[model samples]
Target: MSSASSARSGLRGRTVVVPLIPCPRCQATVRYYVSNTEDHEGWVFYRCPNHSATGCDFWFWEMEYVAYLVDAHFLVGNQAVDAVGATEERREELIRASYERRRIATQVATSRAALARPGSLQQNMSKHQESALIGLGAEILVLLKLLLGSVMLLCALCVLLLMKK
Candidate 1:
């Protein structure tokens, strides 16, 4: 048997067994070692056994066969074995979204207040000045009415004197 074939057979009898599926990194046979086994539950991991020589250290959980474990759970604490960086990326996205929401809220509040009423002291002064001008115009109209009434009375007296002549 060739050296590679001999190595394959030697790996079969050991505690670790070669998986039916091939390794993703090396395309060689992936080896599975059952790290924990109880009567009710068991956990296994698959990796390239020739990782030291081939530098192909791809590993995956046995439970991941049903579904990708990292995607199903948001387990952020387990940094050792998480691939794809999904959890970290999700955390960053959430934080950015929160900040964006706050920023939008602030902008909305500012815009609403700006639109609702005059905020500046200068605008308030202008409004007051307009009201004062309207009041002065009203006073001028009252004085003009009194002056016209006096002029009409004086003209009537003059006509009565002229009739006596």
Candidate 2:
């Protein structure tokens, strides 16, 4: 797919569940990072806290992980759908039809949600595989706090260094 078309496709928009999982190599806390510019904007990944200090190579794309998880779930759902009796060709047709139905249903659901509230940006952050809402508020809050904390920490370090001079 084209880059623009898939910009926020699938699980690309959801916040990565920040696990307090530590880096195996340095035993440092791992953290999530997102690209601010380019096609990778909003794409989240994990890396070691000691990356800057130790040049730690620890990193993972949350997008890839989420895609895998979704694929697994999709497979299971397909199996359930395929349980109904049909010839191989018919089964394939059914799968395609199911996808179309899901797309239509999602659009309908999103429109309904929009009408229910009246006025706001429509957002569907997850799942065959979309619906609607305004935004992922909790995730946004966490991100904002992290940004603010970083700025504060940077200011403190600068002040401390100037004092030592």
Candidate 3:
């Protein structure tokens, strides 16, 4: 088939129209999300909606299909596949390779920039701060009680002196 069609081959209807390419299997919407790859690239997929009574089993990565189309001389851009000249396998191969190279470069940069693994650091810090605050609060309460006691003692001594006078 044409190069672009070959690239987008496996993608069939999606739950959402993400790649703009209809799923070849069910002619449904295709959904896309951030890829786990270093750069969090966009990845697309297709699945029949539960709304469908039969709920035909259809799912595939829009990623692979796009790669294939690029390999086959089809350019998917601006929500349209240039399916005109994907017949030349060699040219398609070159295009796909070029795209792959760029993808790898982006992944490398993303990996490098992501220095820290996300988790407990913030939570731990919050816990420590909270503990410190609780301790400070308790100290304030203790100081208040001590001050009140001293004031009462001073008042009692003053009354005794006045009685002696």
**1-165 per-residue lDDT for model 1 (tens digits):** 123321121212332112234565667866655544332123345566777787786766544421233344422233213333433343455557667767998999997777667655566778999999999999999999999999999999999999999
Writing each residue's lDDT as its tens digit, candidate 3 over 1-165 gives: 122222233322321112334545566543433344632234334344432655665554454544543554444453334322332333455457668978998899887556344544666678789999999999999999999999999999999999999
Q: In model 1, which range of ten residues has the least summed lDDT?
A: 1-10
Worst lDDT window (10 residues) for model 2?
1-10
The candidate scoring highest on TM-score is 1
Question: In candidate 3, how many clashes are counted?
Answer: 10
Candidate 3 pairs with clashing backbones:
7-65, 7-68, 7-69, 12-23, 12-24, 13-23, 13-28, 14-29, 71-92, 73-92
TM of each candidate vs. truth: 0.40, 0.30, 0.32
Model 2 C-alpha lDDT versus the unseen true structure: 0.52
Which candidate, 2 or 3, has the higher TM-score? 3
Better of 1 and 3 by lDDT: 1
* Preferred candidate (TM-score higher): 1 or 2: 1
Please give, for residues 80-132, the per-residue lDDT of candidate 2 as tens digits. Answer: 23322222333355457667767898999988877677334343224312422
Q: Which residue pairs collide in model 2, if any?
A: none
**Predicted structure with the largest lDDT when compared to the true one:** 1
Q: lDDT of each prediction vs. the true structure? A: 0.53, 0.52, 0.51
| Candidate 3 regions with alpha-carbon error over 4 angstroms | 1-120
User: Each candidate: how many clashes?
Assistant: 0, 0, 10
Preferred candidate (lDDT higher): 1 or 2: 1
